[model samples]
Target: MSEADARLQDMELPTALYESTDDGYLATALTIGPWDAGLQHAGPPAALLLREAERAGAIEGGQTVRMAYDIFAPVPVGPVRITASVVRPGRRIELVETVLTAGDERPLMRLSAWRMRARSDGAAPEPPAPHPAASGPEESRRELAAFFTTEVAYHRALDWRFPTGSFNSPGPASAWTTPRCTLVAGEPMTPLQHLLVMTDAASGISAVLDWTTATFANVDLLVSLHRPPRGDWLGMDAVTTLGGTGAAQCTAVLFDAEGPIGRSAQSLFVEPR
Candidate 1:
């Protein structure tokens, strides 16, 4: 396999492909698409795509871009293409966009990198409370070799648990998540990585035994990482707020055995299975 092919076939995106030119690499995550379960469609794979772009120097740090994604029909489980381009570059921020396509359909996602700007003394946003340590389920040591994604690999390393839900349930579920390992790939997890793990677990929310026959997919996901997860064992206590009219949303409070780390919410499209 060529370097481009090697990058695409790298197991990071479940089953993705990569194309290259004089400019940069274009990757496509085939098996995992918009129609796949949220567990697959939303997570490290998407983040990895953006991170790959950053690593490729197509985008710099610090800038905000609205990432609007559309699910034109259901994304298939074959080959998909991810092509990225630099939109704007500035001293403090940069804008970039990447389009993921399978066959003839196109679903695009955008990213904005905003580097920290030097500022004088002024009022700053208050920091979030520390995440509480794993007391009940999060602390339990468990082996996870079944899950294929690297995100799940880290989950097992953290020794957390999902007290209730499974992947395709109806209501909210609790995930005893923690970082099993640190991000040796340069800086700690980018906000994109955090968002990937944060949004992927919604299916487990309905893990309660009674809510087993329902499923939902994210319509939109908004993530604001006040500070990246520095340690392992980030726990997620999640629940659904409004899931109707072919759409749903859920909220989760992330923790890491200190107090409260951060909060995340995702809008989902739902259906009965």
Candidate 2:
């Protein structure tokens, strides 16, 4: 393995994304992204916040039904703090909010999740539509390596396979992704945690414009799950649309090997690279 790849493989983040400090949680290189050399990717922070939310106010027999996040600033790749609280509590449902802040107390991102009790009367409605056949990762593993020239810590920690589209080209796409590393060291991730990590890839998987000359950074992410995702593989059938203005959106139908589990949407700020 390359030096960077070796670092990614043996990083301390396998047990937890950060080490607890009196002030807050410390950031790690594993959270780095390709957007800005000093900024962190949206996935790790989102998952970390969700982890806190789940710990603070998780209901028995409940699953995360919806999760929404708003990025207020570029999340720094250094020490950061997370605060979580229960907004609403109930027997069948609950709402929790988690906020991330940098060392300067500047807000980085805010996330809210809705947890609902699971119910199955043997009459659950049929899935809205059928998803495409499963596509193995080996098919596009080599292509993705060539497509992404920048070395991102998050991308190296996961295995991505595009079955319907090329990452070098732009358009609607379908891909299956699996996490190769844990969000928090030693702490096992729930199904919801696993899904949240992969949801942030919507924009990259379905790029509508040339990535070399333009940039599309998602400012917000919203994901809703009808049922908890199953298995290790998470499938995203994604499409990105850019308006005449600088705004754009990426939407994806989420799935596991079993079937469709939920949907995710991201609002992007398009600009020149």
Candidate 2 lDDT over 1-273, as tens digits, reads: 557666645544433445667877776665777666577879888888888887777687677889999999889877888998899998889999999998778778999999887777589687555555246555544334333444555666567787887556788888877776677665566667777777887788788887768889899999988888877877788899989699999999988777788899999999898
Query: What TM value does model 1 have?
Result: 0.59
lDDT of each: 0.46, 0.77
Q: lDDT by residue for model 1 over 1-273, one digit each (tens)? A: 445435535544322222343443333332233233322344534554456445534323442323333333443433445676666655555555555555564564333433233344477856656444334453444333232343222232233366554344446666665443322232465444544544555444433322334456665544444444444445676777654476766777666554555566666666676
Root-mean-square deviation per candidate: 8.2, 3.2
User: TM-score for all predictions?
Assistant: 0.59, 0.87
What lDDT is obtained when candidate 1 is compared to the true structure? 0.46
Backbone clash count for every predicted candidate, in the order shown: 28, 6
Misplaced by over 4 Å in model 2 are 1-23, 122-130, 133-152
